[model samples]
Target: MRLAVIADVHGNLIALEAVLADIARFSPDLMVNLGDLVSGPFDPAGSAQAQMALGCPTLAGNHERGLTMNGANGLDALARPLLSPDQLGWIAALPATLTLLDGAVFACHGSPAGGDEEYLLEDMSTGRPRLDTEAAIRARLAGSGGAEMVLCGHSHVARMASIGGVLVLNPGSVGMPGYRAALPVPHVVEAGTPHARYALLERGPGGWSAQFHAVPYDVETAARQAERHGRPAIAHSVRTGWMPPA
Candidate 1:
């Protein structure tokens, strides 16, 4: 089975379109979105519509909870008003995690039990995002229900690892590439390039393997949309894939 995974599409339709076009080149058997779908400065409603048209299995990210379940997030607040009832309902119906290929593949926006807030592969205690230890990663996967391959997003960093023969993958972000996260600790996550990211996973006799893709789009156009929406920081991030200086 060949699966194309996209995540953290924080409403940048431009980036999402670019990534989708690139994914078409491979003609994947399945495509799934890992959420954070419509909570950003650009085209939240349109983004929702586009994903709905695809009719793929989509998992909800933390932002989806904020928008529909009353979690406090500024981006959610910004996007909530723009989405119509159908769009809102579609997001609200998404599962936080999904199991596919009859349990061979597990897909979630974050860690299995930690829901949408925890970082399964990242250790943020050091005031930045870094790969966590193998033991720690295993502990996080203890609740994954024994899926052979785990797919997660939210760190917005494309990375892959194999622990105890279990493959773990993060397909990176499809929309915003970087952001300064605040809460458990203040730090920034940057991809260091203005490109839309995704991953293609294929299963063979050997096992499952993944390939990451970064597709270029009209960065200036995306940035200008952010600017017109009064989000200069987002504009800068879209153009350069790095957050503006605080």
Candidate 2:
């Protein structure tokens, strides 16, 4: 089965549309959104409506959880007013994780054990998201009940790692590619390209294999939208795939 995975949209309908159009040519058997759907400076309601129209299963991200928890925080708080009651409810109802392909694949916004906040394949000790050891990745998956493939987002960086023969894949971010955050430590996640990112996964006789795709879209438009929303930092990040100093 071919599955297309997208995550961390964070609004930006233009990027979402462009990515969807690009994915159409591949004609994937399944498409999944890894959530953080409408938590940004762009058109939150529009992005949410468009993603929901895709009719795919969505797993909640940290932003979604934040909104659901308190409805006040970061971009999610700013975007919440733009979304309808139903849209907010839909996002709130999304599951934190999903098991698919009859247990062949496991999907989550972050590490299986830590929900949407943990870094599954990243070691943040350096204050930036860098690849972690296979043993470390395996420990994060320990509570996940092993599968042939594990899919995750939240780091907003495209990466693949093998843990105990299980393939771990992160498709990266769809809308917001570069951003600085103070998590376990102050760090920045950058895709190093201003393109909508996603991943394609397929199961074959040998094993499960994955492909990462970066689709170019109207970055200028997304940037303008962010600027209009009074988020110049997000605008800079969207345009250059690099976070500007605050």
Which structure among the candidates has the greatest lDDT?
Answer: 1
TM-score of each: 0.97, 0.97
Worst 10 residues of 2 by lDDT: 65-74
Q: Worst 10-residue stretch by lDDT in candidate 1?
A: 68-77
Residue-by-residue lDDT tens digits, candidate 1, 69-104: 665568899899899998999888889999988888
lDDT of 2 at 9: 95
Total clashing residue pairs per candidate? 0, 0
Q: All candidates: CA RMSD in angstroms?
A: 1.1, 1.0
lDDT of each: 0.90, 0.88
